[model samples]
Target chain A: MIVAERKPFDEIKNMVSGYKKVLTVGCGTCVAVCLAGGSKEVETLNAELNLAFGKDKIEFGAETVERQCDMEFLAELDAKADEYDALISMACGAGIQFLAERFPNKPVFPAVNTSFIGVNLDVGWYEEKCRACGTCVLGLTGGICPVTLCAKSLFNGPCGGTNQKSCEIDKDQPCAWYKIHERLAGQDRLGQIIEISPPNDWSNQKPRKVIQPGYEERVKALGR
Target chain B: MKSGSNLEKILKAGHFAFTGEVGPPRGANVEALREKVSYLKGNVDMANITDNQTAMVRMSSWAASIICMQEGVEPNFQMVCRDRNRLAMQADILGAYAHGIRNMLCLSGDHQQFGDHPQSKGVFDLDSMQLIGMVKKMRDEGKFLGGADIDGPPELFIGAAANPFAEPFEWRVHRLAKKVAAGADFVQTQCVFNMERIRAWVAQANDMGLTDKVAILPGITPMKSVGMAKYMKNKVPGMDVPDEIIKRLQGVDKKNVADEGIKIACEQIEEFKEMKGVAGVHLMAIEWEHKVPEIAERAGVLPRPEV
Candidate 1:
């Protein structure tokens, strides 16, 4: 899931300081799962902002959508768009961008920092699982993402800093290459890591867009 | 005679090559580096200028290598994949080469958490092995990492680090073999305190014929005191300091611990000299550079070859 964390309190306060009426929009998807932004988080932020502003000079409200990325769910906010001076988006980068695109006139501020696509390790613990590099090599590395796990993002093998199966950088973290080696060795597929990977093609170009081929044809046929 | 660097010449001539390390100053001050280089002059074959070794910011190894060259000391330029991408790495390699640096050591470097700035993002675009391969390609093929032509290729004697003491110990020699296959001309290992493990690793390398493929230089850092010994043994990851050595240090008087450390280091050097497939010794005195001359002299690596 696309994980995110709330921006610092001071930064969020500064972003909404001049606004007299503000709406805090939360996403019930990845941000909620990561405990960064959800309906409860939005209420907490709204209450905090009200207390920080004091004197009731600014009115704060909170709302949450099923998924901020979906245009249908975003339609729920269109009815109250003109009632608020500013909108605070407690969603990932993609969500904030989508929200901004929906309400082009109103100022949209992001309340959280989109971190990475990761998985929940335990309660309150999240580990990055993918870089969205657009090139997948998990089949080669026994399903471990070296591009995101290895500190050096090494594709070939482990570096000299692998100590006791842990990373030399952060002793608490297991060395990604070490884990890959162990997994491949256990599976009797050690030859995969030994083979040098060609340089990444970097196909994840910026602002890239893709449309489902059959969906485009279906849309054209259904056109009124 | 790769790059014809003094270290390479000494190693090629079958002499016990001695290489010293010099950490670049945090600021732009070159006087400290110059003094260290001058102090190490004639006492060692090459002076390795570290590249922000533990991730603490310092004068770049590329600039320090040039400074060392100015001080009449050939430099073994150390580069880590932590700070630069492939483009920056290839550019710096050419820059170092233009500055007359011949020997290059590729390392993955200590994590940023160990350095002063733990928050900085690491740029490990390529690991040490890939870095070695890239350097090899640039030098041998006269092309950049992306396979673009260079006006003049850098003639480099590539070096890679090995930690025989690191865990999954069985794979250490095979890792060294991979580095050699990737174009590492020589291999300098992590500091050696466990001689039995090092001997076993060397034997494994010999069995794999890796010893003949690349020159293996074991790293040695003389402990300054019992505290230093404990830190390396316990705190430093992958460092294997045997109990007997700690006991030996603990047996000595507080003031005599430094000398005891030197004595132990000298013994290790002597053992390395006799070990099969061992090429030389890389003496890392840490901040105790003044004692390197004494350690080298005591280890009979003095009167460095004038090649």
Candidate 2:
């Protein structure tokens, strides 16, 4: 559920200008679900690029390889490496880095801005939920990820900053703390608010790097 | 077959030629259009009547085509998919044909956001290619898009649009090929201000053998003024108007730009006539339909191709 916004077409066009043979690689998992790096989007971008600059100016190609993190899916692009001068990735920052790692010499550019992951409110609209903070606070926050909702990421109960159950930044939006209070009241555990959370640990950053073991076996088995 | 309609004869003839379009005014007034039809009746072989062009609410292309048909003018009814589905499209095509609106142009219209009704829901159940395929299926198989068999298949002379000047010139030829394969009898391209680009597109089309398969009618729109030309270039989708043409229009006197526009259109038609694959020209004077005949005559299309 990684949320992302598309980069403007003009900016993307300029990024791949140097390369005559370009492969637009999209991530089928997260980015696709978010409507960023899907098959349809890749097709549209391909068309846009072909229209702006003739196909001769840029021999553009498009393919949505599976999860960019999975080395197996990433290997699918290896066959096309010789055909492209560069790869334009339509995935999150982490996925783009993975692609860059896979094809060291070939340059990679991102066509989408990797925003926070969440659910779509409706068609062409999205709402942010998880921030992917390694430290789990759901146990204390009554299953609500306060890190994503709270502007201050307060682990404890209602902050004094709340004005009449509304967030300070946007008065119309109900304060995350106030909503947490309502949830706690319903659970008969308002006392849990007084239990202070420990100082946030910075070591959670190391877990961000996803490593898959026995990757070569999987790559060959998958026949990528 | 002795109905011998002008549109029928044109389709039967091998030479693909140019055409021009005019959107009828909003209201019911008919005098201005009458004047235009009277002037263009014999001058230009056919004129396209636009249907709620740009998704903007306006007088129907169907009704206007009916008027022009009665005036002895051949009309290509421009049908857009923004407001209708296969049902409406099929019904409209049948109705237009019944009313002698023989030539039909298929288009996936401009989105509602660009039009007056930004809040209006768009019905894109079928795109231009699907519409082309549907019409083709109807003609070839005697079956409607719904698979319901008709007593007799429609003998429609279908046309679709290709934007060679549409940004991404590489896919222009490919998209046109799809249209032809889908069943477009001919293509009325986006406006052509830059002949070099048009030549490139035509060359691509020829290389793909698409030029031999479908009639390619290059489009020419008379520039109202330098301002209008600039507006069109900046605003219109798939419409590419060169800077030199704008510069030429700018150099002319503003009051006489209409005449200059007609002159430019005539010049374009004359230039297109020399090209090998060009079937004809599609003139889009928009509201200025009266000038088409004069432009055609000036471009040497007036003796009109032998029927």
Candidate 3:
């Protein structure tokens, strides 16, 4: 899931300082699940901004939708959001960009910083899980993503800095390769990791587009 | 004549080799570098010039290595994957070779987080294993990683760092073999203090017949004092310092603790000499270069073997 962190109160407050009526928008998906841009968080930020602005200096409204990245959910606030002087999005980067796109006349501001694609290790804690590098070698590495876990993202094996099952970076951080080797050794699949890996393919054609296969077929059939 | 380096010739002759290291000064203090280089000139077979050791910036290893050459000491230029990308590394390899450097040690550098500038970005476009393979490609096949044929390829002896004492003790040997597979012609293990653990690590490495495949030189960093010993035992990652040695250093007079540390380092080298598959010792007197000559003499590896 995409993880995000809320921008500083001062920064958010300063962004909507000139706007008389500002709506703090929230997304119900990744940012909401991460507790940064949920409806309740939006309410808290709305009240904080109102109080910080003091007595009628600015009017603030809080609203949340299923997901801002999706156009359908964004349609709910498409017309309603434009009435405000500005819109502040408390979603990931994509959501904030989409919100700005949906309400072109109103200024759109981000209230949260999108962190990473990660998993919740526990409540209130998240760790990065993938790099979306377009190449996946998880099967070859015994279920571990050396690309994400290893500090250097080394695929061959652990560097000499792997210490006592921990990384040279820090003792608390377990070396990713150690875990890979352990998992592979247990499965008698160590040979998989022993093989050399060529350099990763990072074909950097930016802002890449991928149309889902079935959806592409449907669109082709419609010929719209 | 892979590299035609003095270190390579000694190892090729089946003679026990001795190598020492020198960390370049933080700035352009050539006098400081030369002083350390002079201390190690005739002491060891070749001096390993470190690149940003401990993640701190220093004189460039290739530049310092060229200086070592001017000072009459052959340099085993160490390149870490932390600081540069493939283009810069390959470019530097050609440049270093042009300056008469024949030896190169590949390492996945210490993380930038542990450096003077923690906020600085790290450019690990290639890890150490890949770096080794890439260098070998340049040397053996006369081809760049981008698969372009080179005008004049660098003839080099590839070196890599091995940490037998790190973790998953059973797998460390296999890890060394993996390095060997990556085209490492030789290697220097992480610093050793616990002889028994490294012995076990080497035993496993020998069982896999890795000793014959590559020259294995275990690193030896002598403790400077009781505090240094304790700090290494507790703070330094991938370093194994036994408590007994710490106790031994502590048992000495405060001034002579360094001597005791040197004695202990000598003792470790003594053990390494008797161990099978161990081809050499990389004495990392870190900042204590002056002590290397004395330590080498006392360790019974003196009258440095002439290849």
Cα-based lDDT for every prediction? 0.88, 0.75, 0.89
Best by TM-score: 3
Q: By DockQ thresholds, what CAPRI class is model 1?
A: medium
- RMSD to true structure for each model, in Å: 2.6, 25.6, 2.1
Stretches > 4 Å off in candidate 1: A8-10, A51-56, A122-124, A202-205, A212-224
- Model 2 per-residue lDDT tens digits across residues B5-117: 45547756755565666677667778666666777777767778888876688778888888877887788888886688668889887787777666788876765666788
What lDDT tens digits, residue by residue, belong to model 1 across residues B229-260?
Answer: 89887788778899999999999998899999
Q: List fnat per candidate, in order.
A: 0.56, 0.00, 0.69
| Candidate 1 lDDT score at position B187 | 87
Each candidate's B-chain TM-score, in sequence, is 0.98, 0.92, 0.98
Q: By TM-score, how accurate is candidate 1?
A: 0.93
**Candidate 3 error regions (>4 Å):** A203-205, A214-224, B305-307
Off by over 4 Å in 2: A1-224, B1-8, B253-256
- Using Cα atoms, each model's DockQ against the true complex is 0.56, 0.01, 0.68
Quote the positional error of residue B130 for candidate 3 in Å.
Answer: 1.1
TM-score of 3: 0.95
- Provide the DockQ value for model 3: 0.68
Could you tell me the lDDT of residue B267 within candidate 1? 95
